[model samples]
Target: MVFTAKEFLQLRETLQIAVVKCSERCLYQSTKWAAELLNSLPPLSVADIASSQNTPGTYVHPAFAPNNDPIEAALEAKELGQYLLAKSFFDCKEFDRCAAVFLPESLLAGLLAPPNDASSPVPGDKGKATASSSSHEVTLPVLSQKSLFLALYAKVISGEKRKDEESEMIMGPQDLGTITNKQLLVVSRFLKRWFDERGSGAGESSASQGFLEYLYGMVLAKEKNDEEALSYLKESVQLFPWNWGAWLEMTNLISRVEQLNIVTPKLPQNIMSFIFHAHTAVNLYQQGQDLAMSINDLISVFPTSSFILTCKALLNYHSKDLMAAEQDFSNILALHPHRLDALDHYSNILYVLNLRPKLAFLAHLCSSIDKFRPESCVVIGNYYSLLSSHEKAVQYFRRALTLDRSCLSAWTLMGHEYVELKNTHAAIESYRRAVDVNRRDYRAWYGLGQTYEVLEMHAYALWYYKKAAGLRPWDGKMWQAVGSCLQKMGRDRDGIKALKRALLADSYYDTSASSFGSTGPVDRMTQMDPEVLLQIASMYDRLEEEDEAKAYMELCVAQEDGGAANAEAGVGGGGGTILGDSVAIHADSPGAGSDGEAGEGAERAVGNEGTGVTVATSKARMWLAKYSMRMEDYETATRLATELCQDGVEVEEAKALIREARSRMEPVNMMES
Candidate 1:
């Protein structure tokens, strides 16, 4: 059936509205309707319209021959019809659909189609005007910029190579060489011309501008010109700050430069402000601020956001509020069970809470969902490690490595397993591989240091420990190791300084509250080897810092709990351990061993007359007796002195202290009190 000019005009408008819905079924119906309309319309030329005018063809129709522009009309109709039919099958979410319809080869071929009827211009060509026209005319608009952009986006989404498993490399620069060389060159030329024509308007184009920049940046980064690519990404974020894709691309670009220690241009102030606030709460939490309180305020502001709740849950986990963290994580799981990050962290909470069966089940579920994912394998491996199934843990870690050679956590955890089995050589190799894969990982550095310390290579251990401490200055454990290492090397003053820094860092990280809702004692020296505590005490003594010496010695005695040999021996059953990886070893010099022996002798008179005396308790009493004598509490000193004499250890020093205390002649009740 032939259509009147007005009918075709009305039909095209109706089809345009349908195409805007952008659904597969909607486009299919629109395409079918367009095809029927195209079939009914005559292929009218300017010559035919003009001839009709001369014939006074019953008042030449306005819609069919409005402009006497046959080429424009033909190109517009052709572009609309082709775009509708092709786009109907270009489902962005379906890889197969995109691959079949909008492949790079297919798209490039369409771009290279010969000039239609010689009246249409190629992509960049502004066709020459006729002899009757004064100005040059072009059909460049027939290139269908929107269709080209959508197809490019689809190709990028479909063809980009994601990592086999997550790693730092997942955020590393991509290799966008999926298309052939000829296709790449042609596509590059077309994009360059497209940019030149509309570049001025790009920044204001919002979503389109950001996406275009992201694509260009990806191409440049693939080719390894990071500086230029970074520039494009920076522009992308600046132009479209709300576009998550552009922001993620910018983050990847920044990570690429930062990993290489390459200097990047300063981001614009607006973008920096945007980025700063995103991470501010996390940084504050790491610095030991109350994240739950801060996050509660944020939750009030954005009550519906799962991300804020997730952050709060993670902060609670770090702060050791296990119950609160479990609840928050459970809430998120109920809402979004497929969130992998939440699942991984929630599984960790289960493990920490000693819900081993639940942890194993969750890990099994994660692996069943995607066994090839390195993270899933690593999670299962971690559960086995916690169970002391070193052999089983090693198998899973190896599996993770097979899936992703760049899995940094797997290498580090493998080292920890070797350490657990007391295989120093294998542990060292594993830790070295971990550091090789990721130089910035403090855990790997700490692992290497621990192995060296185990081998008694003090200098190597000191170097690696310092590296770990430098990477994570907030971690008191590394500083504690550094202090112990320096003391081993006979650098008493430096050791003292490092130990004090460790104490300060430990305090800074103590965010947990007591039952009374007050901050508890921040000193966490229980993790230190009792021998290290003794050495620190000795250092204070040599420095003539009596009060400091007494304080550290008291902590040492409390840690030892009357079992001096346990202090001398390496920590058994992982007493110094946190999270199964760390092994606590107190570095002891030959001189320190003799000092410990002397301390043991002084500890002989530990208990009351009827009570059994232990070496550590006697040492504590001896130190307390000396402290009392120094303070000139004669009565208490004389009592302690008599006890020491009866016990027959440190008798000479006790007698001397008693004599000195007695010379002060203090009242008995006042001195005792």
Candidate 2:
């Protein structure tokens, strides 16, 4: 295929679009084709095209002219061609071929040579040339530095693949851990030599040094030397802020908000830094106006970027705004259907919403695209989980972990499935592994609490629940778990405190979407979980706070009634609650009430058994009747007991309460007579 200059420009624009959209497959195919095209072009044509394009960091020698010097033009063409080919190979996962293109034979030989051999040639000297007529030495092209970084990265990845192969042969398929220093020693030594030579006033530019720094930091990070890796990554970002790769490396090293706050001021205040902050904040689940502002700013700068949209979707997911997250991810997939990143999250949203058809379709689509991907496996697992196929879900989740041991969602979801299957021990192990991979994962900690609670270990459950609550202070579920554990441990006052926090958290989350300008069809009032109120009321009753307990029980009944009325009036549908309005709660469903609301506390019962909201409400009425009798309000007590009997909930208890109330009323009547 032949391309005019205009066509070449169009191709470059296409590549840029692919990159901004985060379409790796598109970028890979384009680069591969472009490399082949450049290789077929004549030396002069290649030189003319390369010089004409405004590629950043591309250096053209002042003394060289394509029209005047055929030799110089050929050398430039060869350099550019090699770099393009290596990048294509890297994108295609042909890491060995990619590295071999940029790394000289001597360096490749030294990779296998003894570590003590000081006779190995430095990597930076590969493309250096001495001009025959001039005293000035020609430095390697700026692309050479990028080529070197790519070569080192390729080698590291190749080594990992070799390790995986060896591990499979030795121990069968299992979780492959982090890359060791021994495996990365070759690349580490090469980068050290490059930096040493550059530090000694070698002709390498700051940009070249930054690339080398990023490579070294990446190697160190893989080798689990995070402290040293962080320093190199920070320097790499400072030296070359345009290298988004380095910014990503820096983001990976800082997991905590405290660490991020300390590092933010030190980074260059540029577009890349803003992006880094936003990305890291999302991963850390640090929600605030600043994260929102950063995402909006990035959207303005890259309006067509699916990557930015994905980030926004992630923020919504972390904030528990399932409706907004669903919309954002839907928009992203509409624009770039081939995107595989975050599909696991999208599937999760569908599962929570009970959009079974959509979740199933997504799983089928992802499977068709690439079934081996961890994300795809997670999606499939969610699909099976939604169908109540716990074993099938576990199988797929295991496959996902086998593909990538650090897959946070895989571990967490597998734990959930194990819990569903009553395999509490397996669930604990999965959750533990998830926390080991990423301590910031509240879901894993929450799962651990649930598992311990199942085993009736209130002390251990409280500890794990507190850890989860600390990570997600605004998550009502975590706070509720903590409160439940405390109450079980006979700590009534502390349980009350935790339950109050849970109520506050729930209120904040229920209204959070409106604050974020979400015009989704959610009715914030109807989104309130009646179970939280019930739990608080029950706790107060246990504490002997008659007035407080009665007030809370009345509040729970009122809210449940209001929610039911709203549902009947069609005031909300497909919005507000995490389950959305579309999913009807069937009476036979283990955890749902007659009013179509799942009782959150009841749903947490062991063996998938649940006490419906109707039953809970009746119990509240029964207690209220008893309270009225004790307070000498016989008429009120009799009325409440009769209502409970009519409702047919707690019939035996209601009837007994009625007889007691009537007997007490007879004594009061006789006294009045």
Candidate 3:
């Protein structure tokens, strides 16, 4: 086995190649061969190997270099063996083993390797690590810069793995928190050292530098230093414009920062096209452009991107294209079953579609993977609530609150569950917590109002309803609640104003039948709508203007008849009145007939409800009878009261009025005699 120096170098290079190309099992099998190959090699420095002169039929061994430490050769062999083993483990996803074997060896190799004089200053602050020239030089039997980075990466991943495993353990919260904190601290120190490693020096490409920055950004993100993390991640993309990994990292950081209303870093013009296209499409959707078109254009460029497809599907769901959105989401799930975004989005779609079985499956699957994610917990809670399992729903909702107390929707939903369970006090507390979490949450404010209204706290209910109205002025139901609360509080003028606003916002707005249990028999089921009209009429009547009251009563009659007609015809007017138009009927004036529309309009105003006109006649006749009696017009009063008795409403009152009018008429007749 006598060999030239070049032959020895070639043999070592061949063994290094074998180590890289073999699998873990193959490497183990070849371990003895590698050891023998290394042991048979002469103690020759690279310079000695290069300087050796070729001699015919003989090996050339040059003079030893001064810096050639014999121990360095052994250390190199040990470092190479460890690096290969760790790499194999890493490739197999055995992070713990990789970290255990590689990190120490990589560190020791750097310390033992002689520093290079030709290398530049280490990057970042002064006193950061500097790499020797041989650090990343991928020669035989030496740890390269790639190996060092991998070792650090494995260590960080191992820490994360421990944290994840411990989180799933049934340990005390305090103990789990302590252990997780220590693991994070260990990872943070390693990341700092990885960043400080000057050995992965200027010779590395800008893309590699970007990778380092990305890793540092990830550490900063874990520490909740989002601003610095964003800065480093942005720097990474700027340094390596071609790296998709960097782009994905930037997208994740931007999404999180934007959720907190934090300003994102400005992207450079040289940004990657796929990210730019996707970002632009989403931005256009936010700006109220045609979301479908934007998403279509994005998909045209990136047809296979699940992220883009998911975005398009979400946009479709929002736009009410449920079937199309469902199909797209299904496609994404089929392609990537574990995609969190797709799972989250499709869960909502399933809920909306009332596909309860699928929703349950999605909730269970998502919870299995993301047990502590508040949104996933909330989804599970909603599934239980749908099943009328308020008790189970509360458990999941409470778990969501524990995970993130600031999840306002969870609090609001918990309030809904409490309300369903008739736990008014708990409901109130949950709503209050929700509002405290986000003052702009009108749902919480409305919930509080509803709860107070139910509790007969009119003043408190009014205050909360007003707050809700201010937050969501266009919500006609809130305005209606405000009106009802005001009316309960005897604020007639304000009540009328709120009621009118409610009508203007939503003409069909009606108070819930269940809300007025204690106050009045009037509710949506029992024509609560007509009650609103009557309330306005009474407010005017209280001002001693009987004519206006009579007019409103007529309008109420017209609305009732229209609703009946719609129902009989099987035409859904959705509880809206089909009064031809807003025709002002003045007090003390006979109702005139409007002719030739879809139906006859008040054809014979005095008593014909069948034509949508006579519905008002019964109330009108009653009011006219009262007015005539008050004016001493006895005959008119008697006749009108008699007609009122024929109608089904106010029969006993009409009979009494008739008796009184006739008795008074007898006196008048005697006077005439």
TM-score of each: 0.54, 0.74, 0.44
Residues 1-673, model 2: lDDT tens digits? 2456665554444434324322222223333323433332223456655765567376553223242334434444667778778778877889888878877546555444543343444455543222221222223323345456667777877887776554431112453343333448888867776666667887623434365787799898877799999998899878755455667777777767899999999988865577788888888876666677778766754555767788898887676666677889998888778768789989877776667788888999899999999999999988887778878888998888778777888888888887878888777888888887777787888888888988999899899999988888877677788988888888988887887777666555545544333554335444334566567778888898877788667655555444433233221112232211212111111112222233233222111122334655776777788888888898999899888888888888888988887887887789999
Q: How many residue pairs clash in each candidate?
A: 2, 0, 6
Candidate 2 Cα misplacement greater than 4 A, ranges:
1-144, 168-181, 193-197, 200-209, 288-290, 520-528, 563-613
- Candidate 1 lDDT: 0.54
Q: Which wins on lDDT, candidate 1 or candidate 2? A: 2
Worst 10 residues of 3 by lDDT: 585-594
TM-score (C-alpha, index-matched) for candidate 2: 0.74
How many residue-pair clashes does candidate 2 contain? 0
Model 3, span 1-673: residue lDDT tens: 1456677676455444434322222223234334333443456696865555455356523222221334434444557777778888887878767766745545544443445434565677354343444464433223433454555566667776666455632212342233442334555555554455544563332224354566677677767686888787777666544434445444544432234233333555531443444553342223124444555654554455666677777555433334456678778867666655445446545544556787788788778878788778877876776566888978887887766555766788778777778888888888887876556566678888888888999999999999877754544556777988988888888887786565444332122211211122222221213445556666667767776666555555545454343223211223333212121110000011111211121121112133332434566567667878888998988887886777666789899999999899898899999
**Residue 562 error, candidate 2, Å:** 3.7
Residue 530 deviation, candidate 3, in Å?
A: 15
Write candidate 1's Cα lDDT for 475-532 as tens digits.
5577888988888888889998777666555434432322112234422322333444
Candidate 2, residue 230: the lDDT equals 90
Between candidates 2 and 3, the TM-score winner: 2
State the TM-score for model 3: 0.44
lDDT of 1 at 223: 57
- Model 1, poorest ten-residue lDDT window? 585-594
